[model samples]
Target: MRTLDSLILDQISGGADAGSLTTADTILVCDDPTGDLTAAACGSGRRVVVLDSDYSRCQRAISLGAQIAGDRRLDEFLAGSNGSAVAVGEMPKSLSRLDYLARSIAGAGFDTVTCVFGANNKHLARSMNETLATSFEEVSASRGRGKFRCLVATGPRNVTYEPAAGDGLVAVGGVFSGARADHGGELLRSALPAQLGRFLDLGCGNGSVSRGLDGDITATDSDADAVLSARAIGLSTTWDDAGSRFPAGTFDTIALNPPFHAGTTVDATLVSSLLDASARLLAPGGCLYLVHNSHLRYRPEVERRLGSVEQVARNQRYTVLRATAR
Candidate 1:
């Protein structure tokens, strides 16, 4: 088992008491993108309600035999809920978003919140623990094991958030690059065809590319927060992981900067999924424009999914590819 998984199993197996989940407990699991923990905890006793701003993660949680509470809405689920909140995966890198998550968990009336995070994200751990400490009456932590940690906080909930404007989107976090455009996004934008017709921004983060262009464009991302941010910037956005809402052959071009990590772990499946989705969405002779780290070998995947691939641009760190649909 993975180190984090083993540690979590140990915690859960030890018992569901002393700030841990107990029989028939209503528990909120946060940031569980993979739904592994939700599935494990769904066996008995606890009623697992998973919350994630990422729409795909929410769907995955539901597929694991856990019912969708609040229609898989993270913000709505966090408000005035009656469950003990627990986070068993990575934390957002954005401090403001982390603060919002912690404050929300505290305010949800959870008497016990247990979080297990990779020790590598010390800043995230420190911030969350501090937030819990300030919001609750008691907080304690386990010694870091193989760069993993479990923190248990219990007591009366005393959390409050000053309602902010714009939902303080950037402040609310979970979007890629945390409110700013990423370098790959900028490179992909610079390489866009001068004139465009129907196109897509697959895996769009804040819809940066589509927001800058004027044309028949659709932006799709798995993250609801990203879709919200994209719409706020006047870009047409859809919250879907695989662009399922759009019919096939619906676009002339697709631009992407697919994320390749699950937390700190580098996983290339996300890149492959984006390439396949772009291939399925493009009309014959349509083009796919994408950017990725120079080290990742996506050329083979592009050739397999789309058609002949051409290097459009390359920097010291990023390589942009143009693949035409056969």
Candidate 2:
């Protein structure tokens, strides 16, 4: 178990009140990719319902005997749990995501629900306590253990659910770049060819790249929240892993602003997998427009996988590359 997970489990299980894990009949887990929390919750002989926005994490939780909140918004799933449940998980890195979770849990109309979320001390913020206080009547923090700390919130206050508002996009918390397009995404969007035949926005967070594009445009993201955000803006999107659900030679033009972070850790494999997928999905003579931090230098990989590559645009922070399939 991660240090944060262990701390959270100890804090909730050690308590003897109604908020104790032993007293609660239902436990809702959020974003537990390792399944450690889900397994521990299930082992306590309570009904475990997991709400993970990431598709891969949802599958992992299901394999651990935790029920998944399929096609249900956070508030909807929490509402079905009858309000007398304990919610636990790792604290999200984004303050907006934390606020969303706190609000959703508070608005679930639970007669009594206590939320226990832990994270590395480095990731914890004073704003998180303030965010939770907006929804719960009482909020407290546990002592640091192995550089991890748990925040406990109880007494849900009645609040209405509201979708997260973005600059021009309707986004859920934790989606990449939130409601606004990042510099890399904007660079790639501007570098796109004038006449894109069939466009595939790979790893399309909030459909920023495909926004306002005409003719056979589709978006796909691994995060369910991202897919929801894209769909809300009238973009056709699929909740998929690197466009794996589509067949080879499916698109004539592909736009990518790949994610480099998996939670707090930088994982280069994410970008590599998308590169391979884009190469496979593009038709003969198809074009790919990708933007990334200049330090990543994806030129060699793009050349190896997708044939010819050229730097189409670059600024201080980002570089846009265009590659053509052989």
List, residue by residue over 278-299, the lDDT tens digit for candidate 2. Answer: 9999999999998988988678
Candidate 2 C-alpha error for residue 196, in Å: 1.8
Pairs in clash, predicted candidate 2: 83-110
Give the distance in Å from residue 243's predicted Cα in candidate 1 to where it truly belongs. Answer: 1.6
Tell me the TM-score of model 1. Answer: 0.79
What's the TM-score of each model vs. the native? 0.79, 0.93
Clashes of 1: 0
Off by over 4 Å in 2: 15-21, 263-266
Which candidate should be chosen as best, given TM-score against the real structure? 2
lDDT of 2 at 148: 86
